[model samples]
Structure formats: C-alpha cells, structure tokens
Target: MRALALYGAATTLGSLVLTALTAAPAGGAAAPAASAFPSFQGAPEAHGTELAAGRALAAGVKFGKCPASEELPAPIQCGTVKVPLDYAAPHGRQIELTVSRLKASGKDPKTKKPVARQGALLYNPGGPGASSMYFPLVSGMPEWKKIASAYDLVGYSPRGVARSAPLSCMDPKDFTAAPTQSPIHPSDSYKKERIARAKTYAQGCARKAGAALRHYHSLNNVRDLDVLRAALGERKLNFMGASYGTYFGAVYATLFPSHVRRMVFDSAVNPDPGQIWYRNNLDQSAAFESRWEDFRTWVAKHHKTYGLGDTAEAVQHSYAKVRAELSHKPAGGKVGPGQLQGAYLQAGYYDDVWAMRATALSQYLKGNPKPLIEQAAPRPEAAKDEENGNAVYTAVECNDAPWPTDFETWDRDNSRLAERAPFETWDNAWMNLPCAYWSAPRQQPVDVRAARGALPPTLILAAERDAATPYKGAQELQKRLPGAALVTEKDAGTHGIGGGANACVNRHMEAYLLTGKTPVRRAACAPHQEPNPVSLDRHALPKRIPAAV
Candidate 1:
C-alpha cells in the first residue's frame, strides 16, 4: 500500500507457502477513452466503434444496458469501456482498464428506483498495481458481493495491470535479485554503477512507455474511475479498496466526495509527495527487523520444535552462515540471492508465516532447503517472454509518486541506511532502482488531503505497526479525511489490518457493508486470531457476501 503490496496469492503457491506472507508487488495495466464524454444514458454514438469493439472483446462492462445486465456475470455482460490516456486532455494516447461486474444476481431491478440503480460497489485490491479483476473471488472480501446483491460489484484493473496494457520493463526475475547482503557501503565504482543502472532502467521505461507513461499515475487512475462512473450511468460511486487501493479510494474521496457512496478504505495509502517511497521503504526495513526478532525469539523459546537456534542472535548467525554459503554455492542448483531475498521479503509482510519461514530457513540451514529454494522466483530465460505478474508492481510504484532522479542522492541515503538495516536496505534499493530510470515523465503526487465536505462517514482499518503501510500512515490519512472513524489494531504487525480469522474487525466490516452499521463509536478491533489450518482449507471454497446496495 505504501509503495506496492500485493494482496493476492500466486498460482503455483507452495503447500507450505502460507497466505500470511505478504505478496510481492505487481504493476502494469492501461486504458482508453469512453463514448464521447458523458455516456451516462447509454454508449455514445461517437464511440460506436469502441462499443462494438468492447462487446466483441468481451469486456464485460455493459453500461448502456445497466439495470438489466445487473443480473449477468461481469465477464459475460459488461462492456469493457476505454478511456483517454490523459484525462485533462481527452484525445491523448489511451489505454484500456478492464471493468466488470457480477450484477446483482437478484430479482429486483434498480428501476424500482428513486434511488437510481443502487449505484455500484467498486472494489480494488492493493499493489498500487494489483487488479480487482480477481476481487470477485477474494475469500475474505465477500463484502463486494454482499453489497452487490442490491447494487453491482464493479471490479477494475488499475493502469497497466491485469488484462490491460501492462507496463513491461524488466522481467520479474530481474527484480528478484540474488539474496546476498545488498549492503549499502559499496566501493566507489560499484555505487556509481548501481546508480547508473537505476538511471538506465528509468530511461528504458521512458523510452518504452513514452508519453503514455506520463499519464499512468494514480491521479489518472482516479480520473479513470470518474469516467467509469459516467459510463455506468451511476451518479455516485461506491467503493471498497484495500491496502494501496485504500489510498486510491482516499484520493477519490478527496477528489469527488460528492459522487462517492458508501466508501470503505481498508488498509490505506496516503500519497504524501513529501514522503519519499525510498525512505519509507527504509522504515519498512526497521519494521521487518522487529518481525525478524519476533521469529527469532519464538524459535528460541521453542528450541525443540524448531531447533533453529537457542537465541535470536544465534539464529542471526545461522542465517548469515546460510546466506554466505548460498553466496558461494547456492543450496539447490538455483536457489541464490534472489531466492533468499524473496523468502526473507515474505517475513516482512505478516507474522503468521514466521514459523514457516523459520522452518524453511531452519531446514535449509540443516541441509534441506528445497522448499525455501523453490520459494525463489525462477529466473526468466527469455527477456521478452519473461513478463511477470510483478510488471505492474514497477508501473505503479515508479510512476505513482515522483522520486529524485539524481543517482547520487540515492547513493548517499542508501549508504547511510545500509549500516544497520542491511537485510533489506540494498534489496529494497535495487527493487526500486528501476524507478530512477522509469519510463514515465515524472508527475508530482497528489497531496491527498482530506475533504472538508464529508460523505457517508466510514471506518478506517489499520495495523499499529504494519510494515508495508505503517500504522502511523493510516493515522495521517485519518487526520486528513474528516468525518472518518478510526479503528486501529493496537500493535499491528498485520499488514491488511483485519485479516485471517480476525472476527472483531471482520464483524464490523461485515456489519458495515451488510447493514451500513459501523462501530457505533470508537472500538478496538481485535488482532487476527491465529490461523487454524483446518478452517483455512475449508474456506478455500469461494466465499460470497451479498452487497445489498
């Protein structure tokens, strides 16, 4: 959310690859213009060609035929409308962001309205890059469907994300660097080269993306949402966004509060232009260190169960030894720096996977790191064919907010932070290094200040010490957004706030979405109950909650 935190699980997930681990960022997706300007009544005559093309393409977002199509599966009935490359200048180069809806699979039509079509309940997952394309099926978030039973569940892919014209930079494996200590203090030539490499990646994106990249920022995404509202014929927009999506929703709330209906920003992002993504990533390094200690302390207490080490410091040595060994000769044929970095990255997201990570590392230290080794994202053999789910990861991050292009600036800060925060300082530095060479023309991030004009006040969910989007960030946004109630998990290590089996939080969310009943006053949303393996497997079946919009 702060930078790019993906909420979805991957396709070929390991059996031990717990859902609790934070998902790596994914960035990519694009869009095009709509029929004329305001096609609220129906698809415009001027855009007849696009309408036809959309229908043929099975975009699944049929706006002209709204109420009736409300009964159709999003992919089947909705028209995949296109919008401008730049909203301020509608005729600019454009891209397509897929929009779909599971129409209220109910008997009633909004034509029963003075209320005007229960509007639409839109959803977005985090990863300044993640697409809500799959939100219709995110197990714990049936709130989309629940509210959709009356309204429609509109899911959209952010710019250059899934099913859209995604931002293609380097392959995913390239981002997955070797897990060596990306220490800050590199020699003069090494520092210069890394900075140069960052510049090159940025320049490559500028070349490849061209003018189109300039318009792909979040402000554009918010404008696109307005276009979506117009296309849907909905006077107001109802949205539920998580993680980075929350930031998206918050920006929209500030931009178009009058048009927003029943908005819920769970696991928020606030684009503070003053807040550098790189420096914030440094903060994440500290948070991850705490979680690392949590794991070490737990492992030490249960020495027999884990047998990894007796003390946190000892485990640290073991970890360093394994890292050193892997550096000289990877455990399996391929597990190297990237694999270790990735596995460790997983630990930074949530505490639920701490034991599993420990187990993997412990086993690896004990000579059986096959499971952990496999965790490393495989290197791509072909450059062009190597596009990964993480392409969007770069797209959103590098473009969402502006970063200083001067390589020397990064080098100085990165060097200073590396001494104590070695685990992720360098890894994070390289992960974001591409931004220095981002293809898009830099745009200033929106201030994302709260609106003085209030909408239907909603609940804000945040973890106290969320690594990716620090809990304080949530409070910052809360301070900005007037008329919003704050719910904090006292000591949040939970990135998504109310995740896993967090009943107290989920109940409030469910109640809020189901009956528009939020916590009457302030309340301490409880911590996520420890995951019950049995309960989770059973929940593997898609969960649905009707959205009685």
Candidate 2:
C-alpha cells in the first residue's frame, strides 16, 4: 500500500478504504479536568522520570529487519511501540502502534558497510484511520531518493488502525447491511432513516469498543507520537503529514514547538479552532462542485471521442439520465445512485480517472450497463475492513470536538447545502452523523498558534482546486504559523500535491528536509498535465482506478 495520500475522505483511498463521515460540527466541548490526556503544561518538551519510563517501555518492544516483498519497493523493518492507553496514567494499561522503517540508503563505498544515518523522518498519510506502516515504502521511492538516503523513513499505523488495536463499530454483516448516506431525495423519510442508521452505528461502536473508544482522539495520538520520538532517541521530530495528517502535525507543532525540527503539511487542514471537522466538510462540498464542473468541461471537449455531448450542460444532462435510470433499476443489482456516485467521485479528486469514468457513463447511456457494474464491483473483505476504517475515523473526529446534538440542526444545514452542492452534501452529512450520538466526551480543539521563532521554519503545500482540503487552508496555516512558507499547485484538483508528479514541489520539499531553509515568499507550481480522452474502446472499462496521488 503506497502512501495513497490518506485524507478525511474514507474512499479517498479508492475502493480499498471505507466511507468516512462527510460533515460534523466544529465546536469544541469542555475539557475534563485531571484526565489521562497530555495538558501541554510547563515547557514545550516533557521531562522527568515518567517520560523516561515510557521511552524505556517503548525501547523494549521487538522489530525484525525487513526483507524484500511484493508489497514493498524495498526492504524495511517492522516493529511496535507501546504507549499507555491513557496518557494521564503512563503506568496504566497500554496499546501498541505498528511501525515500519526503511533505514536510510547510506553506505560507505570503501568499506561496503552501512553508513551512519541521519535522524528518523516520520510520515503520516492522513486517514486518522489510514494504515501508515507501509508509507515509507512509497515515500522512499525513486522520487524521494535524496531524502530517503539522508534519513530513516519511518511510518506507523496509529492506534486503532491496521495492524494495531483496530476499532470496529459493527459486525461484518451489519456493517455491510448499512445503506450509504447518499441523498435519495429531500424527503423526511430519508432523513429519518439516515439518522436511525447513524444511531445504530454509534451505539454499535460503544457496545464493541467500550472504554477503548474514549482514548482514540487526536491528543492521545500526539502524546503517543512524542513518546515515539523519545524512544527513537531523537531530541526533535521531523514529520511529513498530508490532509488529516496536517491536523496531527499542527497539534504536535503547537504542543511541542521546541521539539520540532523540519515539518511539511501538504493540503493542510484548517486549524482555525472554530473550523474543526464539520465546517471543513461543507467547504469540501463547495470545492468539489467547482472541480466537478472542470471535469464536465473536460469531457465535453472530447465529446467526439466519448459520445457524451458537445457541451458541459449536455454532458450533465446525459449523466443525469443515466443516474435516473440507476435510481429506477440498479446495475448488476448493486450500482444504485450511491454506488454510481462512489464510482464518479474520483473525478472530483483527480483528473486521472475522468476519461475512463466518462467512457463508462457513455456506455451506460448507450444501453450497456456492464461498465457501470464493473466500476461498482466489490473488493474482497472491503466490508469488514471498511468498518475498521470508518469506526476509527468516527472515534477520532467525534472525540476531537463537540458536534451539534440536534437532528433539526443537521437536517436544516444539509437541506440548505444540498440545493447548491447536491453531489456530496447529504452523503457527507450522514457520513458524519455518528458524531451527533458519539458516546465519548469531547475536548476543545487545539488553538494552533506558535510564538514567533518558537519552531523551525516549515513548508505548506496546497492545490488550488483541491476538493477535500482546499487551498484556503494553506493560506490560513501560513498566516497562523509565522515565518511558514506556502506552495500552491495552480489549478490542480489533486489533494496531495507534492512528491508524486510535481518535480518543482518535490525540490522545495527536499530542500526543506535536507536544509532547514523555507522560502521567504509564497510560491506556485504548475500542474503536470490536463487529463486527455482515452481510446474509444467502449467495451474496455478499467477494473479499478488507483486513488489520486
């Protein structure tokens, strides 16, 4: 599993991941006094014998040297780090985080022995629930040769993610049985059903996860990350976080500014303290609508090849007709409006899938449904695995802040939004519905402001048309973190903008990692290429499209 650019969207990983809540309140709840969570009291870095004990405990865990495998581009070691389940009680019960590393590719040629490596570079791909243990495999690819050779590329499955103590909201059967939150209509019946299902999912997580659910928020994860820094013997942390990972990095930078070395937050989440999980999703809906128009325009330009239409409006009409037909009769008995949307949403994320998806839609319009059916095909065990991703996503987001408890509030807001941004409005609302009934007590969102010169210079990257984490977030992050530099991928819709296809952005990233200098002024990088129409092979739709990089 390459870095896959984990983010807020569960399906951002394509069919490999599950659906995450689309929207929820950004309001914070009162923090409980005398909790196990870290308080960021006193100086920036922690001291005393308690941290020493946590580090000593972490050091005792075992890791084996890695061997080459099909799943990875290079050999790497896999290990586990143990941290207290509740950071307030460091001596209490503990959980493990699975970590992986591709030791720096440094060798002394004369002696043909491994050379001493620079400090570790920890990376998070951002699902809050996404498995990051294998990210080093992707991050260490040829594109990152310079950085990979200089530092130990480290990754981990955060607590309650894959290979760790994972969270699950429901049994596999019940999980699969749950309907998607796609808006079938603006009817009260649909709203009621959606709320009822959200309740069922929330209650299931409480019944299954019990006390462990309360510890799955972001603050504890940040605490565990600090302990890892100590265990790895690094006085400072060097981190690269994308999407939701940016939020993690932001909190870490705020609480332990003195302990940060060099950090990069690409497609940063807004750390406005007032814009936590909910407002962010609404922003995403608007962004997606804008990007979707771009996709529609691209398809129209290739109408002679796709046979959809000669204009964007015509293309939309043709697509609507197919969607209406799907609503009446699902393709292969599975590709309903929800499944059709799941297949098409990738177009909003990246231009790479536009041609293929358009071809599928064209074929469906021409009285063939096989392409649509294949697009919605189920992955083996995606049901069970998706539950795990969704469960953890909900726990982290719902516990991070207080959500609006009234059903009327949710219904009114989503109803108003759906009129303009119908694509993902309701779908996102239901995705986040579990928060309304979340059992865990909430803590206030961290106000991420660092004193001037408190931390080293940092770099933030954003794509102008990114739908998930929009470009405004990058600007906000730059404004909040004094001396921070911002990089924009002009007109690009891709969520994760650096180190995949953009050499210019990569150069900036490498410079910041190898040397501590960040640009003094904002910068922009051009998109590599606009999507082109695929060959007009109507019968050959791809089995699957990889998630946007």
Candidate 3:
C-alpha cells in the first residue's frame, strides 16, 4: 500500500464480552544481534520473571486527569507508564508510554444504577504506528453502550508511536517529498532511483532515530503492553485489535496464554514467520486488485450517476486515464499519479470511502481538481507523527523476522509480481524497502503455536475481501489457535469488520464476548448494504472517511 493510502477507519470502537476487535528508506547498516528477549515458547510461565518485573514497573505509573479535547468524544484519564528502554538492562534507561482510559460507566442502562465493572479492555488500532489514545472515547458512542458500561476502555500509544517517545526517522519535508514507495511499471532508471531512495530513507532513519530504533520492535511493544496490563491491575488482558494489532494480540497470546482473558482479532495478520514483510504484501497486491475490481463494478453500476463507464473494464480505463493525466500535471500542483493511486487505494479498504474517492476522481476527470488536491494535502503538524508511525512500523515489521538484505531479491521478486499484480505490487514493496537496510538487529519470530488447549477462546473477524490483511491469514490464525473461532463477512471489502454496519458480525462477537461462545465451525456474515452513490458534488462527500491499515 502507498504510505498515504495506508490510513485507517475514522470510527471509534469499544471493548466487549465476546466483542470483537479489531516506513522509509536509507543507508546500509548491518543487521544487529538477536533481541535481549529470547524467543517465546508456549510456556507462559517462562516469562514469569519479566511479567513480574513489568508489574513492578507499573507501581511507578502516574496518572493525571486528561485535559479536555474537542477531538475526543468523551472524557478520559491520561497517564504515563515508565518501562525499561531495554528489558535486559532494566535499570539502564527508561521510557514512558502514554496511556488513556475511559472508566466503565458502571451504570446499567436499564437500571440506570451502578453495576460492578469488569477489567479493562485494552485496544490497539493495528498501525504498529496508529495512535490508540482515541480508542477510549469510542466507548461513549451509543453502539458501544453494552461494552462501555461493562469494562474500562483502555488505549495506549505503543512505544515509538504518537506521544510515546515517538521514533521519527525522516524530516517532515523528506518524508512527504515523494511517494513512500515507488509506483509499478517503472523504467529501469526509475527502479534504480527507487532503490537509491530506499537507501536514503533507511539512512535517514539511522541518523535521526539513533540507537532507540533497536528497541522499537513488536516484541518490545508486546512487553510494554504486558506492563500496561499490570499497571492497570488486570490479572488477565481483554483485547480488541484490527489488522496488525491482530498480529500483536496473537503474539501476546502465544507468550502469555494464561493472561488472555478475552481477545477479538479483526482482519487478522498472518503469523507465518517465513513470509515476514515481503510475501504478505505480495498477497495484498492480489487482494487489492480484486477489491479494485469491486470498486470498479460499483462505479459501473452507478454509470448513470458517475458517467465514468458502464462496464468495470471501461471504468478502469477511465481511472487509468486520470492517472496518466495526473502524471503529466499534478492536480492543484500537488497530487500526482502516485498520490492519486494512494488516495483511491482507500476505496479498496472500505465501501464507505468508495463514493468519496470516486467523486474526487470524477471531479478531477471533469477538470476540477480541488477535491483531489485537498484529499492529498499534507498536515505539517501531523508529518512528524506520521514519520514516527512509519518508523515504528518499519522497526517492528523489519525486525520481527529476517528480511532480504539484498536489494536484488526485492527487485527480482517485485519486478516479477508487478507484471501480474499491477495495482500495489511495487508500492507495497517500496513501503517495506527500508528493511533491506534496517539498522536494528533481527530476532527469531515467536513460535506462535499453542498446544491446542493453551489459550483462551479468541474471536477472529475476517472480511472475505479485505485488501490489507487478507482472509487467508484469518484462516491460518484460526487453525493456529485451536480454541479460536473465525467470523467472516461473506463478501465485505472493509478491513475492520466488527462495530461496522454488519449486525451479523456484531451479534456473533457479542455472543463470544458476553458468553465466551464461538462458532463450533466457521460462521459467515452477510455483507452490509453496499453504499449508494451520493451526489457528485464535492460538498456531498463524506467528511470523515473510515481509516484502514
């Protein structure tokens, strides 16, 4: 996915009983040594010392009332949890993680009286880089009332993301100076340019982030999460994570099976360590291509309104024309062919944004570029945060397992895939190119297998046509966690399935969260109503497009 295109849903979600849940270039630096934390086996007791140490660290947690924010829908408490910079050297250095919580309402809606509160329901929005601080506020929404009244909604910006000692790897200008990854069908020169740019991006991170990059992997973030759980005083954790967050939850479960009270993994990530960052992205290319067809078909179905085309192929031809035109002259002097692809990629993630993105495309095609330009405009204040997120994303992903050190391997594999998977093949690759020169040392991926009976029942949500985290990953994850059951949206394209408009999905999740019941076999949910085309007028488009991983 393109850097800008990788944004997520705009809606907030809450924790529930069965409830569901849920990079840059530069120079060559040798891959470092193994992580201080050894590879985890199925034994949760193996990490007892670390878990205890994490609890001890929690004793020092300090919380203060959160200052009110217009952006936040509900009041939340904000605090910091300090953890060792390197768990192996507990006393050497420490970093603070920003944590937030919306206390359970405790008042039963029917009784309008206090009820005993359940433990915290911690959340991660799967960015490896998305700020989770806003998650608690989601509990205030009416849809989340059941969960909001039952458990504290907890959110924390994982280490190196948002306000948690952010690890920014590039200057704001350099970060957005070009597409974070290269476009497909590149000429040989363009290919060389991309490789060089990847190197430059990696070197920039090494220079900017310094040694802290070493400690930014998911293993560490998972450890930090345990600390947060300890600090929150929860004997076991209940979690909801989407996209990459699903992977995080899986790893957490693998490491601390006994500590998993409840978990809902939406749009689950593949746990195959061998694939690492590369193969999975290749999978995304095909998945997104199929989703693009879905978008095209939607556009074609509304040919009378859009006037783009009467057929999916013709609609694609029109889109290609827009891309070509923008390549020559960027709309409003900003959004180019690449940026256009990035913007429209959102269409593949969710049907909610299909109309908005299509409207922008139609407007651009009709010689009014304002919508497209505005869509691509940068937020300078957010640039640093984006950089930090990207940095941490790379830190965790690249360091999670072995990535090819040779650029040729990247070029050869991507070059071959680009021919067949034209939409995002190259874009996905360049997004992960920094791994070729990542400065952090690599570690063995956690042996995620449980002994079939080791883990608590986990509810897994999968959208059959999800572009980012493909459905197959969910299937694999379900197999890996014997107690876990999978809920699939029949033909939904959205990345995050739960808490959306699907009543079927919501009911199944509620059943699991409230009663700890998962399907004895795979269960499928009907897709939500397909979005109807809105007025083509720019003002009629959605104001808050759903974000995706």
Give the TM-scores of the predictions, in the order they appear: 0.77, 0.86, 0.88
The number of clashing residue pairs in model 2 is 5
lDDT of each model, Cα atoms only? 0.57, 0.71, 0.72
RMSD, every candidate, angstroms: 11.2, 9.8, 9.1
Kindly give the stretch of ten consecutive residues in candidate 3 with the minimal lDDT sum. 17-26
Over 4 Å off, model 3: 1-60, 67-74, 110-114, 178-182, 535-548
Model 2: per-residue Cα lDDT at residue 283:
80
Q: Candidate 1, residues 255-351: lDDT per residue as tens digits?
A: 6666666777676654465664655666666566676665567667766766767998888787777767777887665666546766666556655
TM-score: which candidate is best? 3
lDDT of 3 at 49: 28
| Model 2: per-residue Cα lDDT at residue 255 | 77
Best-to-worst lDDT order: 3, 2, 1
Write one digit per residue (lDDT tens) for candidate 3, span 455-536. 8888999889988888889998888888888889998888787777788888887677666788986898888888869944
* Model 1 segments more than 4 A misplaced: 1-60, 63-79, 105-119, 139-151, 171-181, 184-189, 276-278, 377-391, 437-440, 531-549
**lDDT for 357 (candidate 1):** 64
Poorest lDDT segment (10 consecutive residues) of candidate 1: 20-29
